[model samples]
Target: MRVPTPRLSIPDEPSLALPRSFWKEFARKNWDREPRLFRGLFQAHFPTLEEMFAALVDASERCLRGEIPPMRAVRLYVEHEDGPGGIPYYSMLFPLNRNHLPVREDGNAHAYLERVTRWLGGKRFGVILNRAQCHHWGHWLQMRSFLSGFYETVGVPLAGADSAVFFGNYRYTPFGIHKDDWHIFYFVVEGKKTISLWPFEALSQREEVPKEPGFIHRAGAIHLRDKAEEERLLSQAQLLEGRAGDLMYWPDSYWHRAEPSEGLAVSASLGVAFRPPEFVGAVAPDGWPDRVRHTELPGGRDWRMPATLRTALQQRMGRKSLLALERERTTEWVRLLASGAMEGAAPVLTEAPLSPHEWLLGSPARPLVSFPLPEAQVLVSANGHSRAIPAPPAVRRRLEGLVERLNSGAPQQVEALEEAFFTRLTARAFSRRAFRELLDELVRWRAVRRCEPPASQRR
Candidate 1:
């Protein structure tokens, strides 16, 4: 018997095709405690496996045409078994480098693709797309709907959310057994893949773990390499067999590696890191706006404690400066929370452009995760981007009600949304204008999507 495919008509958490009862059981039994597999439960979520393949192909095509940095980061890895153990090697299918690192417009991406195509047959290869959220339009929409139910049940994950696409026919994980810090949920879109797991206690001394010098998938992981050790661990390992349309979950505590059956296997791994947010990149001193006055200090600044240097430093680190930086950092954190993903730590992908008259509704997954700031302003992030909107006491009250209406997951349309909170008698017409612009931004954020989703978004 199988769990019924969850339909949107159900009252609770319809976005994921999962019942609230199932999530409760998972939270109690398997979440961070053990590995669990749900067979054939997610086919509704991924109606067509071609979407995953298309995502990979699109990334490759983008690489071939020399697109953006996110596309340039897609790598084609080939499995090599000629060595003592099966390992992975770069196929160099898309070669773009600047300062010895892959970047846009630096090398001939097509030349390498042509050279590698002949040798790609028979030999199992993997197509890994980092920041896969940007590659396909369906990824974010489905995830947003799914995550809406997830975050409500699982609570907001600290690492936020991000996505990566793993497509390949590799029999075994090239990096061997490993563990990292993240709550990973893998959606098997095609074929079959199995995972062998061992808790932290099952491993040996740290010094005994062999390390590979190449760019292994996980930089900070213990890669086990002892045949005797492998055989011993397999005897007591818990196997999670994931077939097409299956959803697999394993906590970060377990050292696990995927072993796919002999065929093409594709999975989308949505990982939420178990770590603190990095604010350094989010708010940098060099990137301060022109509003922050910059002036060259006197050469006398070389002296022990020049007053001019002190003044300049104080100006850079003053109270206003600190608040500005804090807002930036807070917005970044809120952006991830609003976007409902920080999994791959990549930029959020915006929806296709929209006209002003386009109809829209709030995202079920992330209706509105906002933080109210002083001066009648509210900061909100949805789908993936963040913005600050004006909200006075009366407007803020009405906005809360609007959000409640949006969370209903109803087939809805927008009509004079600015009037929902702002009265026509109000003298501030520009506030209404900005509020209207905020609605447009919501479309871009995917916080609120078009009334009729594209055919790809249909269940």
Candidate 2:
């Protein structure tokens, strides 16, 4: 993504307000084209105003103390660019383990809220509670009414949704460009989230403008001492600033970043990241099929005694020794299978069995550029079943790397690869079920992209 340099350093100005008419038109277009991000706003309130605020305050205090991790564990993550005078900001994850949290007196949330307010300079704070732990903090007690209003307005069913509630504590933080797996709606419960969003296709267009003495970003922004680069890149982007009580509807594939100015700000937001029912099958290789191959896979080895085997007979060892030797053999098999047959490559397949598509058929591969948008119906009928043709080599390779990095839990690797995938691809690609599934991993990391995958990536 490119960042353009302004001919002038317009000092940080207060957020600008837009007329209702302007927003009405802007929102109508987004809703017509993509409903995933903009849906579920304007619905009835959930958790009640009082209950939501109290929980947010309690969670923020715990986050600042490092008692909770930002995404899962209370670990603070900060990324520093090449520029000087850069500041670090903290982000805390919500839904702390109920079992792990210190049980409070009668679970009085108000006292905990006060303790957090005093800790953070007595100003308001921000928070994001994950769905998994929402119930632990007494949030689920009122979830029924909260969701009822949400479903009524959004016109979308709320059943089986795994959601997270997000609130922003007012402080200075520069969140760079990024994308997310689920569609999100930013409802101003309080405060504001000033956002800058770019069209996914902007990367390929690389709009042109006069050179100036500042920074410019476009096709992959690089911070440099040169001013000429900054001016050209900024011209191609569309900038939007949001304020209190304003709802920002972002398309799934749009790229955006947000930073809250210094003030007392608060907001309640929820998002549903959905996957097809068909995808509910075994979780990759960890399910039933892989279990059958456990003995063959490498990693476990400690005890086993084989009798009447050629190698076992040659060894001629005692019972204890034989058991130890068997354990070693088992462990070796586990490691070999996990690491894959190709040296230097990790094991990516299970030997026990594979789904029909993976075992006997391959995708009707095509050049990535040729696939049609939102309906790349490349699948062919074989034995009365429809099968998805595999993506082209390069595309599949990139996705493969994404699946691996996501599982590895490497922050840097996940961020870099995801940004490239969202910014460089077309809108159709983002709407596809497979691509969306790959992106859901990033959602777990707590990094939100302002948009969904491009239409080009959708199936």
Best by lDDT: 1
Candidate that would win on TM-score = 1
C-alpha lDDT values of all predictions: 0.55, 0.35
lDDT of 1 by residue, 1-459 (tens): 000111132333223546677777778888878878887666355624566555655565566566656444576566655643333433434453221222233233232333344456546666677667666666755555555445556665544566677766666665667776566788887778898987765663466444543212232455445556566667878899988778888877677878757766778887765444444334234422211111110011111212332344446555763866555655564455444444332233356655544556553434455555545666755555666767766666555555555554554445545456566436562365666666666665545557774355466
Tens digit per residue, CA lDDT, model 2, 1-459: 011111111122111223355445554566424422233333333233345545544454555566556554222212222343343334342444432232244244444445555654554444445542232223432232233223333333211233344443434322335445434555544445565565555543334322432112212332323434433444554655555545555554555555545544444444433222112232321221111121221112221212222243245334664754544333332222222111111101112321212211111110001110112222211111122334544454444344333322222232455555555566555434555443342232111112233345345
Clashes of each: 7, 59
Tell me how candidate 2 scores on lDDT: 0.35
- Prediction 2 TM-score vs. true: 0.36
Model 1 misplacement above 4 A: 1-14, 58-73, 85-122, 144-154, 206-236, 280-318, 341-359, 363-365, 369-380, 388-439, 449-459
C-alpha TM-scores of all predictions: 0.66, 0.36
User: Which residue pairs in candidate 1 have backbone atoms (N, alpha carbon, C) closer than 3 angstroms, thus clashing?
Assistant: 148-365, 161-341, 161-342, 161-343, 162-343, 162-344, 339-383
